[model samples]
Target: MIVKPCIAVSAAVGLTSSALVGALHASGPGGLPRGARGTATRGGQGMEATGSGFDLGDWFKQAFTPQTAAAVKKKAGTSTAKKAKAPSGRGCTDAVLVLGGTGKTGQKVVEALLKQKRDVVVASRSKESAAELYDASTPGLFVQSGVDVRDEATLKNKALFDGVTQVVSALGPRFGEEGSSSEAVDFQGVQSAIEAAEAFLEQGDGSSAAPGDQERVLVAPGDSGSDERGPGGAWQPLDDVIMGGRSSSAWQKGVGGGVLERQSGKTFGRWAGTLVTEGGGFCGTVIKDMPFDATGYDGIRIRVRGDGSRYKFRLKPDTKLDNTAERQYQAPFDTVKGEWIEVDLPFESFVAVKRNYVDFNAPRVNEGPAGGKMLSLGLVLSRFGFNEYPNPKYTAGAFQLDLMEISLYKKPRPNFVLVSSASAERYHRLTEEERKNDIPIVALNPGGILNWKYKAETSLRKSSLRHCVVRATGLIAEGKEGDESVRLQMGQGDTLSGRVSREEVGSTVAAALSSSYSAGKTFELRRDEAEDATGKTPDFTSLFRGLVLDEDRSLASAGGASLPLPPFAIVQDPPPPVTEERKQEILNDPRVKARTAASKKPE
Candidate 1:
């Protein structure tokens, strides 16, 4: 399909921004941030926010002190407001650096800065054949600097940190890539970025450096101060975005935006100490991580908007305490759903002099027995209201923010640029405009980004993103001398209750399915009348609920049984094969075993 020029342009510029490009991991497809999120009710679609540019130096000056300036920036020179060409990335720092940029969050940072017209460089080892990679380029937004992240030189290359002020790392290990210990990319990557910044700042001559002799780190912090910073619309400086003012209730937590329901003219949200007005705001957090350098800079700033309800800003910094424990930060905001309100936090508000939230490395626990920092930001729609009587008429309308612009310096920085796109800059640059329209199909393990087997296959042109299922059965091909395929899509627990009794064919079908669905959402088998079935298809929705989300799938044929769990499912960790004894137990479960037995007595 021809991508509209407007969207293509926004995506082009956004993807090309260094901030955006760097934030993206080498992960594929959903590899990096693109400044927007997918909303299901909206058909997984959204409007674009074109990021524009600003003067970085001006903003930098306004926000930092000379000491910070000397430590972060190498050039004592000036920033030209007239869209100066970005610093030529000629010299690499002695430190190896990883740019973990991209996704909705990183996209905003990159495009906002790029609107200021910064040259963006993205690095991820694309496994496209050399021929394919060259042809698959997205111009304007992509300057492919192929750097192997696993290599030490990636960090030590001095050319990376030229004119670099602060290192704002938006790095995090993605869904499939992190090893048990590789999560350290955050702890270690930030340190390396610091080393590079230092080398860049101290390059050429032994210049008199920073006042405190410490490098200022630009990390996304977890909490804010707890003091009472009284006000109406002065913006609350906390990282909490809540669903409803946080109820100590577990049932309502993951229900999306169900926390606050407005009935009649009055709306009531409940929490310990949050109050609401026509323009109140709230933020609840699901923090997972934070940086080591906690107190060197100013407090946190976040962008917010919603039907104004009294909001409570919660913080969960990782310290000696368990992860779920939360301390309230100053919660204030005069919010209107349609606008982006900036909340500036003076570190003083978030300071809990006695209780600090910092846990360097804690064992990861489910209910969060394993604690980290408050890396997550949540929202609660209502809190601290007059009455909970006739639950007020609730409006479930949706609210969204294009980007959160956080200025960490004590004040705004002078000469800093706020770059944005004509439509969320750089999203366009992700795909090869030359090839985006021609993306006939994409394989799940395409380029082998995830080391799992049973590659997922789907078409780009279909309305339903979950278009088709692809599998390499290595099947015993006896069909008219070649290979052919048939795809089936059904809801969870819905099954094709075929009464065929062939155990071999049932097992083959199970094998085929196992190659496709790993540990994913629930899905049931359905018999589509439209499908040209070689035999009778099974009833889908009515039979397959319990078998959907399992690590393995069990099916019961008339005479024998088989289990089909797509390779993606984690059945008995990749090693130490499951003993046949356990396999029998799986098939024995009445809920899991599919009720199809295949043809007329083929046993």
Candidate 2:
């Protein structure tokens, strides 16, 4: 099959080839060791080495003999103490350094780590910009300034990875941009990160086969400030205590907004305002100089219950002065009145409102570094009495808007990531236009970037690090109309065609990164089926199960009782020496001659 030949090229570089390659390991497709061939004979068969360094007995001992804390401490002697004590005044934790943390997918990855409460360090050219792109309110966020992955100097900085264990490179050049081209960032930068990791492992910490190396110290979120908040802590009360007079003086009577506490530690806001005339404007109590930094978060989220009234949520940037309309960003929201509902107001959805009038022509509210530094947040009840609820029946009395939790959220990032890359097959067939204009494509011809990417994949496969490689046809964020669920079609030949959401692509990358089963395997990813495309996530477990490891494929094809794990060794004790009569019979067997002949070929 064409796939078998293609698989051979990939498998040669540490991936799994066809059953033909498995033949080199043992007998038949299963590669089962038989009679422990070539062992020295004693009274009985002696144990033989298979040159794989696979010591069965040692494997069992390591697997069954659990290493208790005492055992680990004893093994390290006093070196463990020295490792635990970081240099005085060094603020570092076992962090996952996310390069390109301000990018779309990069930011999401950071958010996911924060959600897991894992310590994270964002590495970018500007730490300030990176911080603005992340939720500084999230306790574990630390910014590493002046980190250009392509720069060898930065990569060689010994302290760069001081507490870093995992380094995720979402590094890619911005589309159609000049500086930071793919050759520089994606190719060379990735190589630099890998080399730096290797150097760090060699010089800074010795390799130990433990799950997470003991030398890497990590900080928990609770240890930071993320999970801590209370009344009088972040939220504060408004001045004047009256509503209409603050926003406008159109009404004879007014309303007030304050906090109400529930027995379960949940607090709701109390907004009761009365408008006597045609119209009234009331703005709620404002919060100033919020202790938390909301960098990187998408927008503010509020849970509220109101009297079915239309309300406006306003945010003031750079100033704490009350009732200021100029330079304020506002988004209108409707309340359900009786039942509490959560509303997400993304930063992009907000518009600038100056001098109590909307500026429709103003640019999208800036969310840049300085733009995200919000000075105040409050609720506005502008135009609610006459313009909105003009029926007089529901217009004049007290209007209430209850507020529950108010915080910020970003699009949740997937735990694992598997980039859906362009298939190697595409490069095999060059169009007339491709041949004429695509110099880079032609230069990398017949293979293109696929070869470069596969080279990286081969490195990963050869390494002990756990990883997954997903080859995708094309990626799009939004599917064509009527398509909802992200479909996963797997093939080895890379002949599949279609596009999938950038969302699904990012999600798949995240999924593959986290799945143990995905390690040491490659997959062709596509999502062409339009029937089940309701934006539903496909069954990832089953999808990943299809990309079984080579070892797993071999075992499945062997078709017998499941092999027992550890204590289950590869190289077995040699069998007893055959008698002259038995040896004569074995020598006469045709299968033995074939096996013997096959083994004699130079490896």
Candidate 3:
């Protein structure tokens, strides 16, 4: 007589009742009779043993090893596998230059960058001040004083750009100052930095992989006799005719129909047409099946010369929705009439819409695997703005938009990151109660700081380099020392009002440098008092993920309308009102006093 071997296995091995039954029938000694097979239970579907001499558990233990057990765990969808690692910084050697490095926020930025193990060059008007502020023995720290951004010659110093791949402009204007006015420091100073950065890109540092080299050029002038289609794919017109409109448009490649001409030994494309308001008013050109993975990019940068009219750059994601062709993500940009201008459109600014109406619940354009993938792109001259609003800059007539090149850029990595104030846009809308309760300088709008900061931001938006503008709310100046348990709260449309610590602001800026989520986007940031009690550290990734991209607020149609505020735990107890003595204390703060004193003298 043959004796059947007993088998035993742990339930944790993830073997199902069906699998055990199959194994028993296929591998059991002489196969168990049908009547002797175990019964399957509900829920977990575990098997019940019969009186048969064979033990399936013992057999499973003998058949499975640790590796096989792990495999089974994974196959059963219950494995505790580690998540994929996050993307790291550009490189270890890529130096970052920090303007105003000795200032309060700037100092915080410097500390955070050092913590990230990045090489930092501190640019200040006074080198001695920076040297005194930062430790001399600190690793990856360099101080370069006498580098005023107002003077174009000063920013052109080759030493500043040596190994420098990114720039963080923490510079702010001195209120009530003469030479150190907003135009000088806030606007033109940023302009000077952008020009210097562009010049640096043009003059390579002999490194094969330069900062701008990785740009994904979608549409560009090709060699003579080359195909009319660009690297972006075929160009076709999708005019208002589809909706029974009278508007007419076409995509002209090279010198076709006398619409475009060859320049600098290369040909260009033109989207020229007549936009009529009869029935509908819109003209556009699109390229379909253009597979572009804009995962680590800020947004699309276009070099175009147009008729001074506002035009919309639209995109459609690679999705299976039935109305994919009708739905799009668009951002409007104002064009220069006669001269060529490079418009940097960040991915965050693109608004989701269906048939020209804003869709608040629609999925973000860059919201899928690999950041996000695109199926098509188009340029539209439309009379309708978001949510059926009128395009304030729209004009109905013969129009021509000349396109030279289109490409994608990474933000804060190869771009300038500017730290401005949220009050720049909301100063005019502040409530009397808010003004009284807010910080002194913010309420006073000292030296027209609001206007100047807005001007500076506008200049950076129109510049050629990719950029991110972080508009921070009133900062909690006091108690920043040793208070490392703060959480961050961010919002769009400048509707948020609260106090954030300088440490949190600096941490946010440093976090933005390595995160693609912060590129080509603008938002208001503050500290979350409600979260302070949770004892959890701030999650910069989650904070940035909740932000919405900006639309061109310069448009008259895009007035003080704020987007829905991001979710924040309500603060049960608001901080006490600032007393008269407290206000004086804030004004007497070292940074504040220095700026106030400097305003009395000419730079």
Candidate 4:
């Protein structure tokens, strides 16, 4: 009797009666093992199924028949042939939350991570007037409950922390919203969110907060808090990167200090200009004053990359969360070019007496050794010893340097985020290979990307960021949708719609524009970039010019009241077709009346 090894046996014949699957030792075409795992297989006439298109289970079982098992086992080690385990637990780091997670920048960061298979949690920093940044695209990402972020317990979600990483912030002010004090998340509830993150990390619930490697992984380092966000306000860290390593011997000349230069590699200028303000006080850094607390965390460390140029770090006059006064400190560092270095500032540096830090228009509230103060790290480019000074050789100008990273590490390379693989896959299928890789096809959508080549597959499939831009210009040159190829460029907009496929390009000119525009109605949801390239900003002139072209055919069909000629020319009303009474009677039958009527009405 011929025996079949790969297929599962019927209930009547259990495993006892069934044979085990076997594997071949040799490599097959495409470098796959000859069989599924180097397991034993039952190979005979019953299991001689053809190769290609077999189900995964069948492929595994059939390829591992006893006839080839010994060869496979000997050729490859038992461990190398083992099937890898699947990833489990939460999708992202433990409680990977974003304060402004739904905001334009926040969404980008979140999506970038999510596309990398990270689970994300999101929340609006406030309760009212929030933009539509938050929406349904979110699946594995979680949204926090309620608007108040101060209450740690409220933001604590086990599902988030079950497999979470960090708390991030990408929220920013909407246009014209910056005037309101609420525009700055930095001053208000952001601190509350930070406190919540601290609580979450400490209770043994956030073990996934840190990442081990710089590239293969990114750490959570806890949540982020923000403020001073605006159109020109810039991303908070960017501002810090440019201004953190400032130094000077004196105040500006206008304010009675020596000259300062705005170039790179140049240090202090001539003469000992009092580090103090002309009024003998502190006035340089953007500082805050109020009852302060660091909880139990250590001192702040500023991370930046600089050429082997000297830089001075400073502190603020009033530590109050509301105080704007800052004083310079005497710490210096000769930084190497293009490498990250950490500068640690102990709290004790600024606590000294004689309180010479404050020098500004604002007078001292109370005298005796100005008690209220805190260190605010900031840079000073122009000052007494900065540029044109007696110390002529001192160099530091518009520093040609880029800042890549920054953080307040507690100790030497503090493991702010620890990484452990709750689950891992040995082979991560690249994007391009995803489709051709033949994953579950039914699981994907019609227009879904078949290729998963990071940027490789991108070039293969139709869309190109550069081409998307170039084609947009091309389509614009065409003036109207009908005049252009409409080849999936300028995706559906607020105007009408497109089929999202060739067949859907509105069978007619007017239909294509009117239909496709309506399809991509949510284009406005995007902020940093336009929903559709044209909508980058609303311009009726371009829209009119682009849509209403020299060829007014499309507009006319949509009842535009403009068009020199119809899409289809008039037939000149051909002489009334010859009709006889008997012939017309048969065509007029009610059963198929509509077609007969249309046929009789005109050519």
Candidate 5:
């Protein structure tokens, strides 16, 4: 009658007194679990102990209690209920995009989104891999192959952003991966995404569109307002400056400023302005605030679509016209109505002048010390004859000049540009002395992106997309990091290195889609120390919460600069004479036949 429950249980289990004592030692007193050290009540007497916060009685109950299916389900229901308490419509959506979906980071990002029950569109260069990665039977997951962001035609394709709400680019270069370099995937790829986002927002799916539904995601560059004029320097309209003429009838407007207007078909900037040069007065607009340093550029270029009129493309060394130190240079070019033509205004072709009339014989104004730095550029309706006096050329009436792009070029500037994540300064492995010496930074090297990181950042900043730039540390493929114990760590100063699972990076990108707070932010991520042994999906929302949201370039604080890249080299070669005997000799080689046979072997 006085037998304790523990003694009775031990007897049932066929345990001796010594064995019971040993089992009790392992489970602690009264069969309570380890780390259950605290105040306990036994036989109406209080007992004190010190250890974990967990109560001993609660631990014992959990350990001894046998759970039924109903009870297990009830616990799961409790967790589900807790999850339901989160903000409504804050979870994953039908359309999420992973741009470099086949890449290490991109592939992980795709999986993370799918696990959250969100539909994902995986975009990569290879169609087969993209299609093969995920099964079509799984609802909401899709694949897009043969997509190259560096190519505008592919980006402008309507199928690219179909029903897509968010885009996460894990697109980047790995060592030895050919064709997809940092420039192609990181910088240029990002820029393309930005452009696509702008287009998507502008042209919502031909139905009732909400502002939130219209929004998409991607990242690009930033502007310093120093050195590079940024994207703003790409086109400076006539409205930015003052327009003056002898005739009051002359007026100008910055109309149709299209960066990339695919809507309604036409897609080019049209600088439509009226030039009525009555009373023999010259009409023109001065772009005095041209802050760009045109150093290394051979000349300025303008794309014009205008009425057949002789116009003077002018440049000034100084900003002020009142100062005697200022010198003006003008080049006259004839335009064809309705036809777009590029007019190149080289410094060598410019005629220098002290007034509106130029002295063509005066040694071309010496181009000055700032030969390439043309501070002020202008478009003018100049007089027909510049012999001894200025005489009016065209009739005084309505005139228009359609301007597409204005740029400074040595060779023609590329229509598109690609950049690398290694462009970030901290990523540069080079020392200050090496950077100063202007060495070439190879993309395959550890810190290859320093030369182009800034460029990529700048491109993103100039883009139309609302973006979240997450610069991650060294990426580790899934199995490479052992088990999936990914604890996201965010910081600055480029201090964190080691390896982070690509899947973790993907999960973070997927989480970013749900938060508008992530927009206009740049942060760094790395994997923390191991947390558990078992493989489990990380808490993406919690990881995203750790993002710094700071725009500061972490690398700048580290005091690193990009190494100078070598100029483009042209290697010309004469064509080899085609000979049938040489071709046959190569084709009939035994080694070639063996290699061909080996390749043909079934996989």
Candidate 6:
């Protein structure tokens, strides 16, 4: 009767039998099911006797009736939905191991990695659970279970991380679990994973060797003849004289007798120049007709001895519009008088310049279409730095520089990429009102998750391996219609607060692994509700480039510092002034005339 119908409604919503009884009691006695009124009594207690009082026997009978079972089955069927499709791609060259891959956030990370065409290994405690969650047949994705971070032995198993070059620790703590507490899983577990990953990367392929030790040598000492890796053109002069400047320079093959001869009997190139600041203030030697492709290398390294003067090293790209004034990428380095030293010039440090003026719009030396194929190399003693800044060490005198070797070197990629919480820093700093408004912060703070995360981060920072820490704020689940319209925002000083989709966090982690700019940096990541999300892909290069390194002076001060303003936000200084007479002389020069005529007669 009415009681049976009430039981079906309660059971459909997953209510317990005790709750059903309470529901029936709230309905009047006149609304009871098909049981008679009870009148039974035992000792001092009144019992359910037929039609007189409440009867437990009749209640149980009504709760599990056929109608109640059908309602429960219908509810379960409605709740089940079709699973999303898994990513498909070819096997990846480099494998990335994802810890806690079965967790809500971890699955998003795995999905993002798969979309990036990276081989992904999901570490889980239950193989069956991971199998049910993901398509086992998908290429570039492998599931490895029994990976408990608490057990160092499990993490240390070599087979589990065989081809893994990077590790993304998405592990979160399991509260109230005996063995998987915050300290055990968050701090100690992450520390163990880092150690294991470092050992695997270093010992696997000798990536930890000194820079240029096992690398390809583009130019070797005591050799001028062309080899497979050396330049094909002979060293020549391309000084400011071409632009009507009185500055002059020469290149020769002997040691030129100084600390260089004393250290080695090997022959080296000598670049000696005289600076004349009257017309132009630069001198340089150039090597043309030689194409050098620096595809896999990170930067150039040169061994030189100089007269305590600052000089610029430049690379000219092979472009179709060669007759035009193509910008060259240049970076400055200083040398000690008569002392031979090696200088490292990373490709990212070089800026594009034409006629002593920097072109901020041009791509860096390591980027753009022609960046990989370089046509010429130049060594210049310049009176100017980037953006029209005067070089402090410039002097109008003779300068002698000795070059022993020139080669390309690669720095190792990050070994560990940790996905931590932004709340680790903001939880304690939030006001009472802020705390009340944020549910995640309120729930995570009392569990001491922040303390454990801080400990893990400190260990990672102190470790020798290259690392990146991405602290995400308020991770929102995928398919949140309200969140999809927001854009991603990154900041420092823990000052940003908002929701970010878990998928975006995974994409950020994948981007950080291959970027040298991301190494040794920690910043907060969130989404901006004010800005609408766009269809265009994010410029991760610019995003990583904008972040300040951990050792930057701004972050060392008390209370820390706010994020630096964007590159476009800063005011640019004016270019150095050029008089009409000097400009006319440069335009009328024989070199300029010949180049113009050649370009006009082009293909």
State which candidate has the highest TM-score. Answer: 6
| 1 against 2, candidate with superior TM-score | 2
Clash numbers, per candidate? 147, 23, 8, 83, 17, 10
TM-score of 5: 0.37
By the lDDT metric, which is better: model 3 or model 5?
3
Q: What is the C-alpha RMSD of each candidate to the true structure, in Å?
A: 26.1, 21.7, 24.9, 27.3, 26.5, 22.9
TM match of model 1 to true structure? 0.21
lDDT of 5 by residue, 1-603 (tens): 111100000000000011111112211112211121211111111111111122222322222222411101111111111101111222222244455554434545656666755555444444333333345455554444446665657666655655544455554432122333345545565666667656763322311121332211110002122222222333344421234444332222222323323223323433345444444445565556664455434466766677887887877764442243545777778789888897766556677776546665554432465544446666676545464455434545666665554555443111111212221444254455543332111211221233334455555655655556665544432233564454566544333433344456666665565443355455556666566523655554445444443343333332132422221112112123324563444344343333334333343
| TM-score of each predicted structure versus truth | 0.21, 0.37, 0.43, 0.20, 0.37, 0.64
Write the number of the candidate with greater lDDT, choosing between 3 and 6: 3
Q: Which stretches of candidate 4 lie over 4 Å from their true place?
A: 1-293, 317-330, 348-376, 381-396, 404-406, 412-603
In model 6, how large is the Cα lDDT of residue 137?
A: 65
Judge candidate 4 against the unseen true structure and give its global Cα lDDT, from 0 to 1: 0.25
What lDDT does each candidate get?
0.26, 0.42, 0.57, 0.25, 0.42, 0.56
Which window of 10 residues has the lowest lDDT sum in candidate 1? 4-13
Lowest lDDT block of 10, candidate 5? 6-15
Question: For candidate 1, lDDT tens digit of each residue in 408-476?
Answer: 332211111111111111112224352222211111111111111111110111111111121111111
lDDT of model 1 at residue 226? 20
Better of 4 and 5 by lDDT: 5
Of the candidates numbered 4 and 6, which has the greater TM-score value?
6
lDDT of 5 at 316: 72
Look at candidate 3 and give me any clashing residue pairs. 7-57, 7-58, 7-59, 8-57, 8-58, 8-59, 9-57, 348-549
Deviation from native of the Cα of residue 357 in model 5, angstroms: 87
